[model samples]
Target: MAEIKKIGVFTSGGDAPGMNACIRAVVRTAIYMGKEVVGIQQGYQGMIDKKFVPMDARSVRNIIQMGGTVLKTARCMDFRTPEGRAFAYKNLKEEGIDALVPIGGDGTFTGAEFLSREFDIPVVCVPGTIDNDLYGSDYTLGYDTATNTVIDAIDKIRDTAASHDRLFFVEVMGRDSGCIALHAGIAGGAEAILLPEKETAIDELIEKLEQSAEKKTSSIVIIAEGDKNGGAYNVAKRVKEKFNFYDIKVTILGHLQRGGSPSSFDRVLGGRLGYAAVKSLLAGENRKMVGLRNNKVELTDLHEAIHNHTFKLEEDLLEMANILSI
Candidate 1:
């Protein structure tokens, strides 16, 4: 194994809760190993453009409970290009960086894998997206926190819905996958959940609402943002037309789910994943991602994780939703 000296860490893709905790853990762990840590700003772009800052224990202090990333994050479209990758290599060589630890989603890991192969430097990926769509991992770092946030919002919205006897269409964030929507919908006690994994027919949803209206005064339908059939607003319009229900409201939980104090689950998960990432680097494992499987932290090849498709909503839960709502 190469003598551990200075290591670089960066957060990429969308910022989420527990990111600061991950950054803190990596910096503290590396320092305890008698190594200096470099904070790369704006993810891969920072490396390619030579933007970096030194990190210390004090830099991460008081940030453990904070949401969002202290190191900041960005998406660099150019990093996939040969010239950009070459620039990253040259910059790493100039800075004498021994290894890199990237905390992000699949796209970020893909870039990390490319940089590792091109530069011959070890890169460790820590799954840190709220999406929970990364392969080989039961849960991503920020997923629990995001789920709790969505549940909280739903709870508050439920109170208003009941008071006004209104039907609310709550939209949660989840682009290509429905992990967040499914988990949050179940946990939040939503009446109906529309996920990307299944096609939600507007006619069926309206029929359910019309039937439920006879027994229940209010309703809440959680819809994923990536719902191809329609969004909450469009669904609300169709529901009003089909059922003549004019009290429908749409609330898009946009970035609110991404911001909040890191829950205990997320803080602990982030700490463990961060430590595992450093351990992987120390163990001479390169271009791999740290994930939890069988209740234990494990490593997987980043390339496989990036190329594999491992996302699907639980069928039993979907069936249960259909049974209870209809």
Candidate 2:
């Protein structure tokens, strides 16, 4: 077993709900295990620049309900460069960092993997993306809270749509994957869902809306931000022009989905995953991510997990959305 003395933690990529809870868990749990915790600010950039603060139990005090990470986060454009990663390695060595815990999506994990390999430091990733697209885990830490947020927005939009017999085009964030859009669309009973993996035909969506209009039913379309054919704005305009559904409106959920108190599920999962991540480091695990699989927390090699694409909507849910809307 490796001698786990000082462990470093950072939140990377986009900020998501429940990031604070995860950071709190890691700091508190690592402190409980008699290890000094270091909080790296602004993700990988902090590590490259050697910017970090000592994290204690008091540092994470009363932050479990917070929306964003107290340590903050950022996108490190230099992480891919040899100079940047080497600088990070030099800093970690100088700081005597024994292990690393990164809370982030795929891009963040990729950076962690590089650092782990370059510096011979063990990294245990805690998946913390709203996209819920990380492989080997059924759910990411911030996904449930984000989904609930999106669903809440959709519910409100539906109320206005129903009252005025209007058609609403709601946009949610999901750049490389459509998990958020797919899950929220099914849960919110959206009339249509546009994902990035598949092409959305504007004509087909408009036709469906036209049919619904004939039947005196208002429609709500959910579009992932990464939709191939522009976004909700373009789709809504086309529908209005062709079918004259002048009551169309557009609501971009934007960062709203990324902020709020994490739901109970997220809090519990974050704690469990955070604790397991520390345990992995103590157990001499390196360059791996701790994930929940088949109702058990397990570890997977970060390299394989990053390269493997694993997010997709269930066919049953898609079919149900089609049936319910039709």
Candidate 3:
């Protein structure tokens, strides 16, 4: 490996809060280390298209508090092909981007792993997804903010539900993971939470709602989008078939969970991971990811981070959520 002179940073896959904060940290950290920084707009697609922009401390100023990403992001099917990666490598060489910091989820790290191995480019990743499903990090970049957003929505929905004596099925984003649904459900005081990690039968859910109906005039059920019983609409439909007392309403948070200013926790985590990513690349580490584990910055193999998913919903929290909801 050669000394990393300039680093390129990009965000990919779905956008998340605190990405700008991560970008700021990457830019400032690299500059502080006497390495130039190039912001790759739109992620791998930008690498292929040569969408490179020079970045300095001034360029990242006033962006840490902003939500979403300043460098932009996109899903690039072209990047999945070898030819596309070759073109991206050529572009990186042309732009003198000797190392890379990619902030994104599993899909993002998978791409980085391929590019780094194929082209021998030094690359590090920062987890920047709202799902918080990644393996290494205790919390991904936007999980806190997204959960807070869901809690706010749940609070408002609870007010309405109480007034109308309604049964609200609030769906939150978490297609493959239940991190968002579990955290937000517990925080929002949902009567029942359906997660993708747990196979929740509609009949069982109805049974729980039935119990809640006996004790309360209004109820809230948090459903992850990837729940086996389907989304909030389907769950609400099935529940309405049997447990039809209060007027049932469904609210899919959708991308609402992905936007808004990041909370202090997310901002700090983003900054830490980004700073560590630059430091790792400079330290000659490649195909790695910077993550916050047990409140400390740690490094994990990118392949392990992408392939071996160690993220698990805490059983104690699940048990508590069940007990408290009752």
Candidate 3: Cα lDDT at 18: 93
Ranking the candidates on TM-score from highest down gives 3, 1, 2
Tens-place lDDT per residue, model 3, 230-292, is 798888888887877889999988998899999999999989999999998888899998998
Cα lDDT listed for each candidate: 0.87, 0.87, 0.92
Kindly report which residue stretches of model 1 are placed more than 4 angstroms away from their true locations once superposed: 324-326
| Candidate 1: 10-residue stretch with minimal lDDT | 237-246
Question: Per-prediction TM-score, please?
Answer: 0.96, 0.95, 0.99
Summed backbone clashes in each candidate are 0, 0, 0
Choose the strongest candidate by TM-score: 3
Residue 94 lDDT (model 1)? 85
Question: Lowest-lDDT window of 10 residues in candidate 2?
Answer: 310-319
**Candidate 2, residues 1-326: lDDT per residue as tens digits?**
46989999999988877778888888998999999999999989998888889989998888888888888898888888989999888888788877899999889998888877776788999999898888889888889999999999999998888999888999999887888998899899888899898787888887777777787657789999999978889877877778776488999999999899999988888888999999889888888888888768989899977998765667787777789876
Candidate 3 ranges beyond 4 A from true positions? none
Cα lDDT tens digits for candidate 1, 103-198: 999889988888888768899999989998888788898899999999999999999999999999998888888888888888777888998888
RMSD for each of the candidates = 1.4, 1.5, 0.8
Clashing residue pairs in candidate 3 (N, C-alpha, C atoms within 3 angstroms): none
Q: How does residue 163 of candidate 1 score in lDDT?
A: 96
